[model samples]
Target: MFEQIIAGIEGRIGGPARKVVVDRGVKPDNARHELGRHNPKVVIPLGREGIEMVAAGNPDVPVIAGAILHPSPSTARFHTTVTLNTDPLLLFGRLKSVAPATKRIIVIHDPNKSEGVIRAANDAAGQLGLDLTVIKVRDRRSAAWMYEAVFSSIDGSKDVVWLPTDTTTVDDTVILPLILEQSWKRSFPVISSTPSHMERGVLLALYPDYSKIGNALGSIAIDAVGGGARNGAVFSRQVQAAVNERTARHLGLKLSDDLRRQFDAVFPALAPLSR
Candidate 1:
């Protein structure tokens, strides 16, 4: 991913002045060498640890980061970041394309850890004329308990549950099976974060295609700051929606040829959906 991003960045600014570095997080000697070795135009750290190590080692360098899922609270001023997390706007657009009548989106989260994401989802839902239903699991409980509370209100015809990136409240092995089981019975769809979710019976899974993310990050950096970039998280618009044909089939959805075209990738091309 980083390599693709570097290739993209270099495309804009013609030079042999970039590298797709393997991040050595917080290793003092290596960090020093890597951070100090380059007085190049921009330093783009691929992940969170790389971003951190770069900031710690040399705050003066302009750093553009990629593949970090969540933006840090105290991000440095000279560092600009692009994340692998799907943008809410893009998610809404794709959801609209593939399943237009999805009237409600249910989100389960540990509210304390996910206020921002929940708020963004709510905004996205409102804009698309959908209700954003939130199920706050203040504490972790059994998967069955969580499912019962969540499924009690799901309207099979109009409701869809959105699985956020939060793992504390809903781990895949525990919560996904229960959610898929309930949704299967009701015949509603579920949207989630990773592409794997599509194979696991989730109707739609939205994620970043790393190469695409790299392209966007480089483009944003180029447009925003040519030679000198500053800190602030850039919302990456590069997103991929994976569809589960089996789940769609069960719901009686003939995902349109046009709608199918919206997906950047689909999972289980030939494998059966998990129970």
Candidate 2:
């Protein structure tokens, strides 16, 4: 990922002739070696540790990050922070494509963690003419109960459950199995931001396009210092979709070969023929 990011940075800065400093939360002495006399115009970090490392070095230097989790107070340090969470609007739009009859988008999330996501989802629902049913839960216990209630009311023919990137509201070990079980029994579709969920019977997943995300980060970083990029969170528009073909078959979807071709991945990939 960082290699793609470096390639992206080099692309924007007139190719490989220009060097972008790379650091992995190294000690101060090594930091000097990595950053010494570079006087970098921008810094792109990986995680919280990287963010802190770069920010501590020069708070004013523009920092662009990708693949980080929900913003905490600490994230304010970055001039631009791109989250790993897929954009709700984009996700909803894909949901519309895969399940055109879906009328309601159901989600259980922590209000504090998913404020922006819900806000965008509401707009997307309105534009797509789908009902957005959002339930806020403060913790895992409440989230579990809420999931049961919400799953019970789900109209399989017209409702799609959304599993966002929120760990508090969607723990893999506990909540994922419950949702999958409900989905199987009820015959409803489930969509997630996490791609690996497709292997576990999720109908679809929309995840980052690493190259495009890296390029976008480099673009934003360049604009931050030179063209004045906005200082806030934005979702990665460059995305790829994966589908569970078995799940689609279960839902009775008759997607054409062209539509199937569009997907970046398909679950239960065919095994090679023996020689």
Candidate 3:
């Protein structure tokens, strides 16, 4: 991803004097050697140690910014069921306003150990003064079991379903179709972390511009390399924000114009439903 972004920057610069050297990651020493093959004027380390070593080895050839690549925080938040519950008070509050009589919301965890989505959802609910029941599933079979269990526990009335951003759940080969099937049959909006999900038919999602993040990092890398700054100064941190719109409309939810205007990007152009 960084490589692609760097390529874009290079295209913009359009000069042979501006050479880019990507350090890749720490474990992949091959990336360093491969970069070396290109004979770049500077080397951009990816991590702390790599940056330090490169700085020490070539004091004159300043190390450019390092790359700190994690799943986009907003994207992470979208997958996070906890954030839905705790942090984004507006989202949960809206849900409450839309479904005033709603007593309990069911959160679905996609059986992935590393997923942070569940935590975000729980947090979002708490922020809205709402209560939720979380269900974890390991596979299609387990998902079915959990779904049934949730239905059984509810009062035979419709309930809101929350889906976390878990790779296992988003995998088209595995969970997406199943989720879409459930959504269509149940008429329940499935909240996810990626806009692609909303585009594909899931009710709603809140995601980040991962490609933009990559591009941002790439631009930073170019600056660091060109400016001859140390890696720590250039690439130690990042700024990220949320992007949601496609998800809201897909699920038939209305976003307030004020809130939509405040966002980095909004999907549908529907009128604001609330202040």
What tens-digit string does per-residue lDDT give for candidate 3 at 1-275?
Answer: 44543454455345333443434343344544545556665444433344433433443343343233222222221111111111234445545654455566776666454244346556767776667777766766676566656544444134666655444334555456655555554455554445555445554344433344334444554565666333222211122223345544444556667655644444442222211
- TM-score (C-alpha) between model 3 and the true structure: 0.49
What are the per-model C-alpha RMSD values against the true structure? 3.1, 4.7, 9.5
Best by lDDT: 2
Error at 156, model 2, angstroms: 0.6
Off by over 4 Å in 1: 1-33, 74-76, 142-144, 224-231, 266-275
Q: Please give the lDDT score at residue 157 for candidate 2.
A: 91
- Cα displacement (angstroms), candidate 1, residue 147, comes to 2.7
Q: Top model by TM-score, which number?
A: 2
Each candidate: what lDDT? 0.70, 0.77, 0.46
lDDT of 2 by residue, 188-259 (tens): 998999977888889899998777777788788778878585568776777899988888888877667887
Q: What is candidate 1's lDDT per residue for 1-275, written digit by digit as tens? A: 66666666666556544554555546666676766776655566777677777667664646677777677753545457776767776777677776788888877787666666777777778888888877777665743476687788768778888877777666777667777777888788888877777767888877776666766666656655565545477556777678887778788878777777767775543333344
lDDT of 2 at 17: 27
| Reference-based lDDT, residue 225, model 2 | 78
Worst 10-residue stretch by lDDT in candidate 3? 77-86
- State every prediction's TM-score relative to the real structure: 0.84, 0.85, 0.49
Candidate 1 residue pairs that clash: 77-231
